[model samples]
Target: MAKAYWIATYRSIADPDALAAYAKVSGPAIAAAGGRVLVRGTPAQVYEAGLNERTVVIEFDSVDAARAAHDSEAYQHALSLLGEGAVRDIRIVEGAEG
Candidate 1:
């Protein structure tokens, strides 16, 4: 099975308290969903296109695993915290096979 990855950028963080609260509540939820956060708060030096403030990358065993994470109750609950916490752009991409 091909590994799956998620690339996301957070925008419109109007409330830092909400972000912190959500992170506190949701951080572990992501781990429970069988996803690994590869990158978080890494500096992005974009050569082209616009840049976003916060970036996150997650990896899963396969596309199915990635979907499972999103569909899981833990991740779903975590997602709920995004409404007032932050706006995000999320994309799922398949990794190249070895």
Candidate 2:
């Protein structure tokens, strides 16, 4: 099966502290679920129509694993801590095979 990737792009951050709290818990939860964080940061440069915002990418064994990690109890708690802290777009995509 192709590897899966969880991509999150933050459109806006209203509360940095809240987002920080979420990250603390979410990181461990994702690691426990076998996710490897591939990228986490704002873009170094923005192209056309691209916003210079925070983006995160995580690799998982498969799509199912990524979904499970997102729905896990620990992640849910982290989401609660991040309630309305920021606006983000998140997606889980299957990687292309070579």
Candidate 3:
């Protein structure tokens, strides 16, 4: 099966401190589920109607693993800390095989 990718685009950050807390646990939660962060930062350029936002990309062994990571207790705890802290758009996609 093709690898899965998790993409999170932060539209707005209301509480940096809370997000920082979320970041702490989120990394380990993802790693535990065999996910690796590929990119994380503000986009250098935007075209069309793209909103300026912080973006993060994570790769997982499979879509099920990606979903599991998001639904795990560790991640859920992290998300609780992030509640109302930021507006984000997140997606999971299967990567094309070469």
Using lDDT, give the best candidate's number: 2
Global CA lDDT of candidate 2, please? 0.98
Q: What's model 1's TM-score? A: 0.86
Model 3 weakest 10-residue run by lDDT:
43-52
Q: For each candidate, what TM-score against the reference?
A: 0.86, 0.97, 0.96
Q: Please give, for residues 1-98, the per-residue lDDT of candidate 2 as tens digits.
A: 99999999999999999999999999999999999999999999999999998999999999999999999999999999999999999999999999
How many backbone collisions does model 2 have? 0
lDDT (Cα, 0-100) at 40 in candidate 2? 98
Q: Please give, for residues 13-62, the per-residue lDDT of candidate 3 as tens digits.
A: 99999899999989998898899999999989999998789999999989
- Look at candidate 2 and give me any clashing residue pairs: none
Q: After TM-score superposition, what is the CA distance of residue 24 in candidate 1 from its true location, in Å?
A: 1.8
lDDT for 39 in candidate 3 is 95
lDDT of 1 by residue, 1-98 (tens): 88899888887787787777777766687677778999999455765666756888899888888888777888777667655767778888999999
Badly placed stretches (over 4 Å) of model 1 are: 42-44
Q: Candidate 1: which pairs clash?
A: none
Runs in model 3 deviating more than 4 A are none
The candidate scoring highest on TM-score is 2
The residue ranges of model 2 lying beyond 4 angstroms of the native Cα positions read none
